[model samples]
Target: MKTFKSNVELVFNNLNSEKPSRNTIGILAIKERFETALPRSIPLNGYSLESHQKNEYSRWLKINTVATKFKNYKAVYISLKHPDRAPGDITAAEMRFVANIADHYSGGLVRTSHTQNLLLPLVHNSNLVSLWRELSSTNLSAANIDTMQDIICCPGFEFCSLANTTSIPIAHEIQNLFTDPDELQALGNIQIKISGCMNACGHHHIGHIGILGVDKKGEEWFQITLGGRADEKLQLGKRLGPAVDRASITSTVEVIIRHYLSERIDQQEHFLTTLDRIGIDSFKEAVYG
Candidate 1:
């Protein structure tokens, strides 16, 4: 497979070989040509690895689910969960099902969120239960929207050319660790964002628990950040000490969580608030120690 650099070179070469069209090719035309000529595996962004076929289906599904109305529609929101790494990948069959629900219940309207989840806006109160049941059957419903298990992760070395390590698997492991609903509820609302590199495509800088992947002498290492939040009161997370190995990433997170649990004033107080009150040194010591 050719790299993005090579693909650019190919575009220039092809442009040079062809007769000048008004002395320059249109930007859209150039983009189209480059896309057609390049291999599908070439990573352009986090969504580069996503299947186009699935994306098209998702578009159709979202377009059809707009302005749906039922009683108490104002109070209901339908959230569609996309797995880590592979965001917005609803199958054609699944899309049809969701679209049918939207058409029947919602005024055939759906909204795609920046968090990579789909929202069925204004779902009627009467249809909420049926909608959720239908969505649950297909396993497309989001369990924890603003909770800890609702993780945000970037496409790491598996797809991005700029990535230093694999992030998706780590995200999956972290999610698995919080499988028990009670345990998750105890932890309260926590945002964990993982990026394969310092570019912060996963919005790690604004996560309550931010993990940035780095390369240390060809080995994968992760740097942890604490106290960041992307909500109403936004703040950048503070970096803990040095980076840790991939194997210890999950354990390190556990230590941080444990430290918070022990140190927190109450369950109502969020992890960020606790970190702010106690400071980063305490969490750093817990992780490194």
Candidate 2:
């Protein structure tokens, strides 16, 4: 007594034509059938399952840096985040340095992270110390991956025509407040994303702390948000309150950070975890008061 569409809905494990939370309705509808009808072919190229052995140099080199080991090689994260430099900016000389490193240590293979950092994906474990030393020599060995200073920012009014304010100075000001490496490590993976406009080129929507610039009666104002995440479990941040003046934005951020430090259960507890436990209410009180 039912139509063809009614039976199709039953195939997707739903009585109604409602979509899945994680995937599109079209994907859910066609995935199983599409895979079942796909042609299988052998890959022309072959690879080894053999893994590389652990080496001594990688141990020390990986202590502060994210030299993640794998079956074939170790992947090293090269931080571009420096206090004086713009969040994602790298000089021509630094680019050449990284290129040389890639050729020498990573088999000429390198990768860029979504967060605007570089990664040497095919680094040999034995070459890690040499790599680290060379990086440190040129001040390219910034180890602040996933820390507070590892900011994701958009080129605001400086470069973009659609911006509400300048973002580079704001980022630098915030970075200056947290210079102690020990303190940075303790903060533990709180991302700060800043957008010049609503286009969200900086991915501000999903930062642990999101800052957006807005034009207010010919003046620049910033709006802050909390609890965003850009990961496997992606989430958008909630607005903190009304936009604050440019001068007060950095101080407001500091208050929020101090509040998290005060409320965290332990040093190892991540900022996101602390936010989850204590809730954004604590941050609200700290920033507003």
Candidate 3:
């Protein structure tokens, strides 16, 4: 068995190994040259900790160390957390610290954003201590399931020129509305996605609750769709009604969720399952009503 110092090296070694013979020097050099260059800490980006092998993981301390290295660069940072597995473990303080460190190191500021992640852009190396202290006092340094915002959303029409509506604004509004910790915890593994157009860039096709925008007579109309999927069970969302106006979108979705709550047998019943058992016709009636 052999191990490569960096993930890149490991990839090259694997490629070379496919030639019916092992590149022994390549393997040895991988051990020699790149090992030290391997990030001492995990990079905050997804790549640094993304699972390369089964049950294998990067060291948290090392990941933390690597994060400091980028304290002051002009970059955007994003992260994902599995909140269903834990609750409120990551704190605003930890987020604040990451932002502070990013600002200090880069001479920029940290911004805790709607999408669940930390930002430390425009930070510089010289201000790492102050950034660290600021973050420490704010309580923003947890990395477990507890202290995470496990939100998933889409670009919608803002980036895509074809968008019929704006997914970002709706996503932001929904995120703000659902600020209650108890509400989030009760939602329990729910995934909400929105698309500005029927193209489904927001992956609304797969969201437990999906929103799609459509054009009607030069006016923005949104379709409330249901029961679309992409995983092992692939399905497309069915339109619940003719497109409604922008102002009504959130209210319509709320009505649908309220319907689900009324019919759900227990807290464990997820959005999809509730939709499944109740049938879309029920949602259609409620939406149209």
Best by lDDT: 2
RMSD of every prediction: 14.9, 9.1, 12.1
Question: lDDT score, residue 200, model 2?
Answer: 92
Each model's C-alpha lDDT? 0.71, 0.78, 0.56
Could you arrange the candidates by TM-score from highest to lowest? Answer: 2, 1, 3
Q: What is residue 272's positional error in candidate 1, in angstroms?
A: 1.0
True-structure lDDT of candidate 3? 0.56
TM-score of 3: 0.53
Tens-place lDDT per residue, model 1, 1-289, is 5798887776777667756444256754676766422111112233221365344334323322344333234323333333342543467897788788767665676666766566766665445445555665777655556566677788898789999998888877787777664576678878889999989998999989999999999999999988888779988998898989988999899898889999999999888889889999999888887
| Model 2 spans > 4 angstroms off | 1-69
Which residue segments of model 3 deviate by more than 4 Å? 1-160
Residue 78 in model 3: lDDT: 29
Clash-forming residue pairs, model 1: 64-108, 65-108, 65-109, 65-110, 66-107, 66-108, 66-109, 67-107, 68-106, 68-107
lDDT of 2: 0.78
Q: Relative to the unseen true structure, what is the C-alpha lDDT of residue 103 in candidate 3, on a scale of 0 to 100? A: 44
Instruction: lDDT for model 1, please.
Output: 0.71
Question: For residues 43-73, what per-residue lDDT tens digits would candidate 3 score against the true structure?
Answer: 3333222344211122112222244444333
